[model samples]
Target: CLGVAIFKKKDSVEGTREVYKDQRGRILVVEFIYGGMNFRLINIYVPNIEVDRREILEELKGLVVGKCIIVGDFNIKCSRLDVGKGVKVRWEKSRGIGMLMEIMREKGLLDVWRYENPEKREFTRRQLKEGTLKQRLHDKSHAIFNAHLVSKAVL
Candidate 1:
């Protein structure tokens, strides 16, 4: 299961900051919980396609929380290396995704995946052969910003 919630105040945060579950029934939330010592966790699902992912980024910038560990599938993509290949007809329709990337940059949302895996590989759409959702470019099909997490605090 996935969850999305926004809180205004900073000091008002406490236990179970945000409640959510996973495929194996694990309770998840956003808060400062250090691993066996000190840390925090913040899970988010920035809207894509229809809504702007920047809103969430702005909200994060507005808040002054401690040791945040945000993790979620921010449905977005910028280049073909992120996904695979895309069709020009469908590529033109993914303007929202481009905006989401901009928002992420403006809000200082670092791509943890990119940092963790610098080799540059596609994580989703393994089934798409070579003519599904990509344009007729050299590398533009897997251009979706899917399955990733952005965070300011380390885990």
Candidate 2:
């Protein structure tokens, strides 16, 4: 039942699959034309295991042309910057995360929320363990990239 839902404005013209589902119910991507600009919105759900990481990243690499905004639950812990308080965690270097970072660097994508709130500690999902609040990093991070000319009004 894992999926992604997109609600678009009525004026936008939709396009074909910029990226299709590499795995059923796991990845969904769409392209749109708004104000004469192309925008690709990727919605993904990476499993909480390590095996699917390569497949996910490969699918993502295929979809990185033109303007894109990738949004999804990447079930990997990639950075300490997205972690909040109450639990101490270290950043472990992984091949999947390294690929993702490389993609971001090569494609000119930015972590939208983290860019806006650099020093702030917040969590999109939190859990209580041993009577202490531990914020899990999965839902708290979203990777949003702007590849082409973005309007000042949209900023």
Candidate 3:
């Protein structure tokens, strides 16, 4: 199941509220004020199916219009670098990655981790087949840290 969660307590940060969400329940965007500026936090869980992922990207790529940080399990690799060593490349993988990179570029988003650590690789896990990609997908500029894949952009 796809899910997005943001926890708020009575003492939690003020000026935080949900702004947008996809009817499909795959995306939930929240706006919050920090350092006297407003920014959006886009939480997403992209479907594994190629067709479904494409549909989500059609909507998600537009979310970078303002200052925002997007995070989630995209299920798709961002590039050849995202694929594990010797993994058999497939049409779906290539298609998905190209679409993702295209969206990032056209939207002026930056891949945070790739920009900072160009050669860095995830050290926690490895895959013998298919792929294991945890990309920090971003569009404009800023910063957000997370255990799951994450990225930031500023407009």
Candidate 4:
């Protein structure tokens, strides 16, 4: 059976998508596209406070394909600096977070905002005193890949 829906009253839509459960039990996949590009976006909610590095890596490997961009509130922290000094001091070296770093190194999918500007400090979790992030500050939690477009442009 195909799980498909379309709302084309005001805009053109393309492609088909399916949602299925995997062994780990806490993962969700949202596959979509825009401007003729394909994307495999996965939202993962990891269980087990201890880092299951291989499991996370394997789970990611299973979902990947051409022109992919995985996005979500990854339970693992990417960098210590993301959580301010006070919070940074409390976190022990988490092997699971380390695996996420390894995945980025193995995959050419660049964190788009980071690629464009390296100096920007990203803080996904914030304190109330810090105030709301201005609308301009919203792109920090995403990673984007454009190898498809780059190859096409080169040709």
User: Per-candidate RMSD vs. true structure?
Assistant: 8.7, 4.6, 5.5, 7.0
Off by over 4 Å in 4: 1-12, 23-25, 51-54, 89-92, 122-124, 127-155
Instruction: Give the Cα error of residue 70 in candidate 3, in Å.
Output: 0.6
Ranking by TM-score: 2, 3, 4, 1
Report the number of clashing residue pairs per model: 27, 0, 5, 0
Ranking by lDDT: 3, 2, 4, 1
| lDDT by residue (tens digit), candidate 1, 120-149 | 665533444575454221122222343333
Model 1's alpha-carbon lDDT is 0.46
Q: Report the C-alpha lDDT of model 2 over 1-155, residue by residue, as the tens digit.
A: 54665667665575644446554676677877777777777776666566777777777777766777777766554556555643454446443677777777777777766665666555556688898777644334443221121212334
Looking at model 3, which ten-residue stretch has the lowest summed lDDT? Answer: 139-148
Per residue, candidate 4 scores C-alpha lDDT tens digits across 1-155 of 22212223334434636544456555556556567866555555554455454575578766655566555434454554334444532345654655666666666555555555555555434445556432212244443211111111211
Q: What are the Cα lDDT values of the candidates?
A: 0.46, 0.60, 0.63, 0.47
Candidate 1: list runs displaced more than 4 Å. Answer: 1-29, 35-38, 52-57, 86-109, 127-155
Question: Deviation in angstroms for 36 in model 3?
Answer: 0.5
Q: Of the pair 2 and 4, which is ahead by lDDT?
A: 2
Q: Report the lDDT tens digits of candidate 3 across residue range 7-86.
A: 66675555988888888788888988767777777887778777888988788887765676777656665544555555
> Top lDDT: which candidate number?
3
Could you tell me which residue pairs clash in candidate 2?
Answer: none
TM per candidate comes to 0.50, 0.74, 0.72, 0.59
Native-to-model Cα distance after best TM-score fit, residue 73 in candidate 4, in Å: 1.4
lDDT of 4 at 2: 24
State how far residue 97 of model 1 sits from its true place (Å).
5.6
